[model samples]
Target: MGFLDGIRASKSQSNNKSKPPNNHFVAKDIVFNVDYLEKRFSDCSDIVFRKIKSNHKTNKDTIVLVFTDGLVEGMSINDGIIKQINLYSQIYNSKKINIDLLQNLLLVNEINRSNNFDEIIENILSGNTALFLEGSDEALILNTRGWESRAVEESSVESVIRGSKDAFVENIRTNTALIRRKLKDPNLKVKDLKVGSRSNTSIAVVYIGDITNQQLLNYVVNKLEEIEIDGIFDSGYIEQLLEENTYSLFPQMQVTERPDKVCANLLEGRMAILVDGSPDALILPIGFIQLFQSPGDYYERLVFANFVRLIRFFGFIIATTFPAIYVAITTFHQEILPTDFVLDIAKSRVEVPFPPIIEVLLMEGTIELLREASDRLPIKIGQTIGIVGAIVIGDAAVRANIVSPTMVVVIAITVIGSYIFPHFSTSYTMRFIRIPMILMAATFGAFGIIITWTWLIYHLCSLNSFGFAYLSPFAPSNLVDMKDAAIRAPLFGLKTRPIPTPKGKKSRK
Candidate 1:
């Protein structure tokens, strides 16, 4: 292992410096401290430590600079640190070294003193230069953290017609800045913590202090603190850990790459969690209806937004129950169909050997497989392959009597409805559980579809996002919240925030 306790597997021997004792404090002897660090970071080639001897009227004292390579900009080191320190001896000539003098001479924006090994190691690894004086127990940590990162670009996943073009990159500081740009309120609160004991990845919690509910904020913060994972590569990990219902298929927290969406939620009294190295942010206390909402909903006019929301609601119903209903009606409740349309469907299925349920399962299963393959493939070819592949495969299957023509229509419409969800993960829930719903319909007809949805609603009611109801405004039925639930009211009409406002901030009445 290297400077980080469990980072690397390489090790080497140092000739003059044995490992330091259990006391992990910096010693006044700079040579002893340098040897201690060199031994700890034995095999780490990226860690750089340079020894410098300060000029003195009588005797010279040594100074050591330790920093990680590739993280600190060269100009920052050249113009800022090295040039200033090199020019120090010509300017100041003193017998006794001054800690305050050295601190003042450093050309860095931020500097902090730390006497212990923990702080020194942390700062060095976090792209900052550590200054260990010859005869001082404390070292100064300089802020030279700069590196090349992907520039902010249009969101590829969450694109919109009328909204902010910029999206969050893999940088946490940049992500926070994006959120800050949207809401410039003094009440906005941002907190940072380190998770993943092995990785020590940075995580941030963002919310409006006065508008956000204290209990809700505490629940989110506590849930995050309780996670004891070795590493968290993405916000998805934080989302799962913060979820109240671990077994539920539905996502309790909404994940978005758009800063506008996050800011909108925070203004609604919700909290968001952003993880370092991950582009997505997790919005908490989300409900079932939010899956259908998009950032464009607010950007567009209220009349148009209301109309689009209704279409989404209809799409959800069609996606969840349409296939099951088709299978049930054709298999058990055929009498309900119109006589002429029934004849057309019967003629189409004359060559098909399988039952309606089996045909649907086979078609739906094939679509899911093609969808997965397309996703795993490169984006350039994936979209073309998915569209052409679905059409070709469906036509061939129908021609070969593997599935009925009408069955292909049902599955295609179901697939379209599945894609109607604004959130990709939410769309997956429908694609994932559609087969089971079809099975129920195959077994017990319309009654089975009724039973499955009824039980599903019950499950949704039982689930909670942090402490708030998952099916909020619908199960509990708040008319005020209803103004923005399935329909978008005018801006002035939505005076009340969607989430519960913090006490004393605003009266619900």
Candidate 2:
């Protein structure tokens, strides 16, 4: 009780932190301001500080430019900004330095003046050059944000047979542009946000204005505002924070790199979050069935799409429970198997010393290790390792009698079935839970598998992502949403948008 009380006290103290103090306004002394900025940015080698004068001998006052070195364009600062400032100062040397006068003189497109020191520092760090004058208490922010970024290409992870080849880039503006290209309607709105008090990373909350529920928008906005953290480097961070059940193993938000996928979700009254440094966007209020969806599902013929969707649905099931079923039947439910099949399995296991569950685990662990290794290796080498390594290792294990031939076949099918889902997160969840299901099956035969699935169903039905049921249109049994869940019921059949959009209004396009 004493330790628990201490923990409670710590939590209370953390929650009672005072609001941050207001930032001091920029001072009129150029040297003093430069010294202060340099002190704040101490040890940061990339910070560039330059001072220029209109006439070195004539004017006693000078202008100071502060920015991050690589983040800004040297050409833009030299030709566009610095040249114009100098040209203006020489022509009007008698004129006093002021925010208004300098604003008219600068040749920059995105310019703003701020007296707050915090804003100035933020602009400089964000790749904009900050201009400070000798006699003015305000700084001019000249936007010259630029840096080499990965070129947008078809997402290697979420690849499709048919769909847009372009994916979201790490840069937020570039990603927003991709979304804009897909959604040209005036109703499409993007709200710029800042998270992570220390990192101050930019986030773009995108939604379709008129079509999206206002209440849902407000809830999402409020949730974002409530976040207080040191840094948010990826959309995954935001996804974890936004989740109502942080303890749940299942991903509460859908992550996608394709901009078209974001646009489609937006049209359905759902909101998306795009973080600055992350290429993936978070699609909220995701249902379990939504995890099975692919962007290509809607691009192909109805027959083809449904056929593929069915394969994925069944494949996921087989991947998740096939090994467990095998273990349960061979260990305790052998009477349920045919005599020929039992004989084949018994014959295969004659040379093997381990039980069915142990055999499955050994094979599964080896496959998982190989999969993880391939992911961490270089692309070309990774593919070779995944294919060649699996074949070589499986063959060696079978011959060495480390595992039975039948067990090897079961594990192989399970691995292949798990690969059907386009969403890697969902695939990972299946892999994560498979071992537990196998353990339970080994203990309770088929009863254990039944118990595990029943609990999963109940837990899924109980869960919601921002108030949108995880097992939507299934547990709640909404016929309207069922058309798009497991089956791609013709494009025309999906006439209505998602009714529930993560605490959003029910009405949608």
Q: Which candidate achieves the best TM-score against the true structure?
A: 1
Can you write out model 2's per-residue Cα lDDT over 307-408, one digit (the tens) per residue?
999999899898889999999999999999899999989999898989988899899889989999999999999999999999999999999999988888
Give the TM-scores of the predictions, in the order they appear.
0.92, 0.91
The lDDT, on a scale of 0 to 1, for candidate 1 is: 0.82
Query: Candidates' lDDT values, in order?
Result: 0.82, 0.84
Writing each residue's lDDT as its tens digit, candidate 1 over 2-24 gives 23221111112324434346558
Candidate 2 similarity to native, TM-score = 0.91
Off by over 4 Å in 2: 1-23, 89-98, 501-509
Per-residue lDDT of 375 in model 1: 96
Q: Which lDDT value does model 1 have at 284?
A: 82
